[model samples]
Target: MKQKDTGVMLLFVTTLTVIIWLWAAGQTKTEATVTTTVRFKAPEGMTSTVTPSFASVTLTLAGPRSAVNTAKAACANGLDLTVAETDGTVSINDIASRLNALDELKTSGATTVSAEPSAFNVDIQTMVQVEAAVEAVLSNVTVSGDVTVNPATVTLSIPKRIRATLPDAITVQAVVSDSALQQLSPGVVHTRDAAIRLPIPLDVPDVTVSPSRVEVTFKIQSMKEETVIPQVRIILAGPPEDYASYTVELPRKTISNVTVEGDIDIIDGIKSGEYAVFAVIRLASRDMEQLISSKPVTSFLAIGKDGAGHQLDVSVENPDALNVELNIAPVSGAE
Candidate 1:
């Protein structure tokens, strides 16, 4: 009877210890579920040709308390996506499975993981490089100095499908900010690095631009104006065949002392004859009789030539001289 009692007590103690161990294990490793987001990262050298339907996915991780928490934190950090070489498809289930396999989320820890979208597909393309010209966007505000841009061009990676839509010329632009005007020093050149903008239309898609910035150099100077009187002359505008035998002249009295306005330095040059400024009267054989019989022919300023070939912007101040008298004479030796 004593032996029997001792054996029964020992068995009862063992059974109680086993129940306590099981209860403690259940308390520490409770089953739990967590909801989190999985962010996708693009692989190198590969870019999406089309916008993805979704940017991220919601995940429900089910496992032990510690394991579920670990996965919840990992998912919070996002996941590096991998695409299948065969079809470039990403399997959401596979990603979840991989997450569940993580050592932190041991099989004993995490029972399973689920993703909202079971799977999805992406369109990828290889980048093609093309060189495009750079256009300058400047405000109408006058610049006192010469303006220039370094690297007047840019290189872009264009999607092959959209390449044909690109015109024979592709262009980017660099804008000169109004703020730049405040930094200008008269007669002094100033340079600043500016951002280059791609003016791709909405229709054109998937393009990457390189060297997105360019150096812009310009000068600022005070504009000066002045007035002067310069001599005027007329040259027939019709074909030489029609005027070969005709000599054209203007009555000196009609055009003498005509007032002119332009850049001070340029006007001074014109007064000194360093640059030529003149006017022309239109004469055509079709209207020759009407012109000779009609009143003074109308004359307008024409580009006058200097040995240096610089353009002059001089204009006549007197409204009357805009019309002039034409004395036409036949050359002595003409057919």
Candidate 2:
């Protein structure tokens, strides 16, 4: 009986000591520095801007060990702040005070000694939805007619401050995909849905379009036709004073096997002589002065149209061959 009683007393004493140690540990004061994210949310019908959308804040907390740990965990998760003001800056101290009052920190009994980044700015603006015109943008193909968009306009939700800075009318782009461009051919209308994009200076996070995609319809035209012009005349032209004083001569008066590439109609006109191609050696006063030395000068031959007067949108093949030598001499007895 005595032995059993002694064993019971020893067990009781050990249990009491363990309880006291645990209680003391719980009451121990501690400090911890934790890095956490500070997130700002705007009120309804509004938007906010910050230099870095994901801002990290370091906090120094002091309290009981358990409370400090709990608060640190809470802060690491994140602190969300609702910004009520439409425009202005929120100081770091103001933000820290608000954080200390939060339920998580209050319940944990942790005091925030300091928060780093000492300051930050917030730009809040009211949001407004407006109608913006939509247009189609295509590439790597020749479009014959005006590109048409089905909806013609999209609803844009943008910040009021940005809208105030913008022009009265806003236009968005619906870009066609590269795969669709590869399959497009001439002489037929093509239709495809393209995603809308805002023009630069307005393309920002605060601006959003309701309809993400729009249908674009357009027709492709045959873009390339190659033809050989049998003969192209070469003429020497200059300023009136230079022409009167200097006579220019070319070894070859005309060039043959001149290949050109352009629209089918334009190429046909060139082949049928309805359009004329001439290589002109345009002389300036400088050229007249240089020719006075009697040395042959090389000049670029510029392709020109005849008096018929039509826009020449043609690419000449081997343009380097068109560069010629101009042998110029002063006219007899004319200074």
Against the reference, the lDDT scores of all candidates come to 0.59, 0.73
Q: What is the lDDT of candidate 1?
A: 0.59
Expressed as tens digits, the lDDT of each residue in 1-335 for candidate 1 is 99999999999999999998876654465444455444444445554343353346666666555566666666565555544332244444455665555554454455555665656656544446778887766543345545788888888887655666667777788776757654555576777777777775612446777787888887655433445554555444665676777666656534555555454466667667666655545567755434373234344342436334333344455655556566767777877
Pairs of colliding residues, candidate 1: 144-221, 145-219
TM-scores for all predictions:
0.49, 0.60
Clash count for each candidate, listed in order shown: 2, 0
Model 2 quality (TM-score): 0.60
Choose the strongest candidate by TM-score: 2
The true-versus-predicted C-alpha distance at residue 182 of model 2, in Å, is 5.4
Q: Tens digit of lDDT per residue, candidate 2, span 7-109?
A: 9999999999999998789779988899999887775555545434457888889988888989988887898766665555554355567678888888988
Q: What is the lDDT of residue 113 in candidate 1?
A: 52
Which 10 consecutive positions of candidate 2 have the poorest summed lDDT? 293-302
Q: Please give the TM-score that candidate 1 achieves against the real structure.
A: 0.49
